[model samples]
Target: MAWAWLVSRAAALGSGASGLAGRVWKIGADDPRRAVHGLKVGLALALVSVFYYTRPLYDGVGGAAMWAVMTVVVVFEYTVGGCVYKGFNRATATVSAGAVALGVHWIASKSGDRFEPVIRSGSLFLLAAAATFSRFIPTVKARFDYGVTIFILTYSLVAVSGYRVDALLAMAQQRISTVAIGISICLAVCVLICPVWAGQELHRLTARNMDKLAGAVEACVEGYFAEEE
Candidate 1:
């Protein structure tokens, strides 16, 4: 009886696995574009991986090569517009935050040891608070919420780490460089291979809706004329 029960359980598991495979196949079959998007993403990742796989490139970035990978994963979107939007936000935020951090670090350093911690802490609190508050504004929230969030995060890390990390400038430069490399690869792939433009999609949708509305209006007018006749 126990042997029979075990066999039945194995059969059930096998059927479930087959069902899952079938569903996955159906999704790809229903929309070939999904498969194309997947391929594009894979290509972008492969291109970015060259930074780590090639000796010269790897040596240039050193351990920071992983930032390129992370940036690609985080910023890549299905549509070109989305990818560009996110990439621009990330790059701008990183640079701005890094600059501010460096400036603050310089100032704090010049203020002597006793006041350095106090200055750093005060700057952190004030900047973080202001960035957070900006999110509440409709215009800023709509267009730059992501950038602001990244700014807060990047600034906090640099400011906090500056306490112990003497080579803050080098560290920030490596990260920014890797991120830029990743963004460039992603944008290139998105634009060159199976390009999907969000603006085009929006245009198509708008035209379709306009056509439907026109047809509805024509039908209403025809009905009213026929009734008057």
Candidate 2:
């Protein structure tokens, strides 16, 4: 059953990616909006690459710079609003989760390596169970779903990664910083560079549809009264 579910999820993701790739090349200058969005995507990725290559902050943020770069790739959207919403979600989720992970690592570190495996493994199970359960509640799930998801992932990484790395909290901190940086870059680029807003597009579409509907109704009413004239 689990294998079947995994396969189904993978297939869905692959299908969606293929569909987007197929449509991307079809975009042309006739629809400049698509071109603009494509440009934003490219620019965001370029910024990520620049940060990853340049160890501008060689202190604590260098090791996990790739995580920041990855965040930029995943967080950016065609619309400014979408980018903002997802950027906030990703950063909030990652930082909150990383804090918890760091706390667990600290406790394990003081206790010594004899109990490290047991402590880390136990924490992973407990955290995952609670988080997975919390995700079912409607209101809770809607807002902090990403947070819960990230918490689990971050905890697991810390648990396993601490075994090899002496500075578990340091790594987690670096990861959190990288995520913030990546999200900031994405938000800046999306807002400053020929910004497109989802809310504005939605309003425009709604207004246009209402106008079209009104025109159709007026035409129909006039035709119905023609016999009286």
Candidate 3:
């Protein structure tokens, strides 16, 4: 149950990350190119979390192989999308770090029988930081923070699995079929319903923000002209 809560919270964070990335594109944020960067960063972070928890879904494969496959997917999808959205040459530091973390996951998984707490914790921190920072950070340098968040998250999962493999396995089984179906339905409904619901809320908030911004700008303009006169 606790793991389920953590997973749900992480998914929410990922969804918000996606929405924020979209907002960055819509608004032409600083270096409009960063919007594409943000999207890739968000996708990479989300994929890492997905890959870490879904290990049992695949059979008999070593952790390294599984990690490699997921890393490739994240890279290919992000690169393809980034090329289309921003341009072929428009890669960000975040994407590079994402690749590095994926490689690390593979290595850590293959290294030993017992999970490495340090590496796992580091990965979780990187992932969480990446997802949070990609959309919110205006500074380009902060993009690598996702690496730390994901490192920590992956490590935590390993710790749980190491201690209670049966429990973790059971959770995985329940989540795979049931959670997937439930979430698929919920997402479909959200797509159908949220636009109308969220649209109204967003419109109201946007209007309010515009009003405040307009008043502030007007006051600034008037003050400047008054000084000139």
Candidate 4:
């Protein structure tokens, strides 16, 4: 009975894998552009991974190289506009947050051990609350929502961790630099390699739709005149 149960589970898993493969193939077949996009992403990742694989590059950023990898993963988008938009927002947010955190860390450091924790905690709460609230504002939400979110995350991480970390400035700088590197790589890959422009795609789709609508109207008008005649 156990053997039979194991075999049944294996068969189910195999069927699931087959179905997944079929769906993947269908998606690629439906739009070859999607496959190209996937290749672009893989190429970008490989380019960024050099910071990890090369000794000189690894030494420069150290463990912070991982941030570059994460940046590539998060910032790379299907469209060039989207990728640039996200990359800019992330880099700006990280720098802004890191600077503010450094300032707060400095202030807290001078306040004596007893008050240091209090100051950091209070600042974290206030900044986080403010950032979260800003997300509700229409304009900010539309353009800068992702930036605000990154601000909150980066600020919280640096401010809270600064308490125990001696080289807070160095760490923040390394991370910011690595993030910039990643953004640069993503932009380069997205723009230079079989680039996908969102604006062009939208324009083409709109033109096609307009043509269809015009054809339909022309047919309707001809049918009406024929009926009258």
Question: Against the true structure, whose lDDT is highest?
Answer: 4
Worst 10 residues of 3 by lDDT: 81-90
Misplaced by over 4 Å in model 1 are: 203-229
Question: Which of 1 and 3 is the better model by TM-score?
Answer: 1
| lDDT string, candidate 4, 1-229, tens digits | 9999999999999999999999999999987889999999999999999999999999999889999999999999999999989998999999999999999999999999999999999999999999999999999999999999999999999998899899999999999999999999999999998888998999989999999999999999999999999
Count of backbone clashes, every candidate in sequence:
0, 0, 25, 0
What TM-score, computed on C-alpha atoms, does each candidate reach?
Answer: 0.83, 0.78, 0.27, 0.85
How do the residues 1-229 of candidate 3 rate in per-residue lDDT, one tens digit apiece?
9999999999999999999988867777644534554554454445434544675743323343344333333333222322222211112332343345445555656766565556656666766566556645665334334343433444345443543353433433332333233223323332332122444646878999999999999999999999999
State the C-alpha lDDT per candidate.
0.93, 0.81, 0.46, 0.95
Please list the residue runs of candidate 4 whose C-alpha ends up more than 4 Å from where it truly belongs after superposition: 1-26, 211-229
Model 2 — TM-score against the truth? Answer: 0.78
Cα lDDT tens digits, model 2, 1-229, are 9999999999999999999887775665446777887788888888777766766764447768788778878888888878877877777777776777777878877888798778888888888999899999998698777667776787788677877888766787788888888888888888998888787989989999999999999999999899679
If ranked by lDDT, best first, what sequence of candidates would result? 4, 1, 2, 3
> Which candidate has the highest TM-score of all?
4
- Give the per-residue lDDT digits (tens) of candidate 1, residues 74-141: 88898999999999999999999999999999999999999999999999999999999999999999
Question: Global CA lDDT of candidate 1, please?
Answer: 0.93
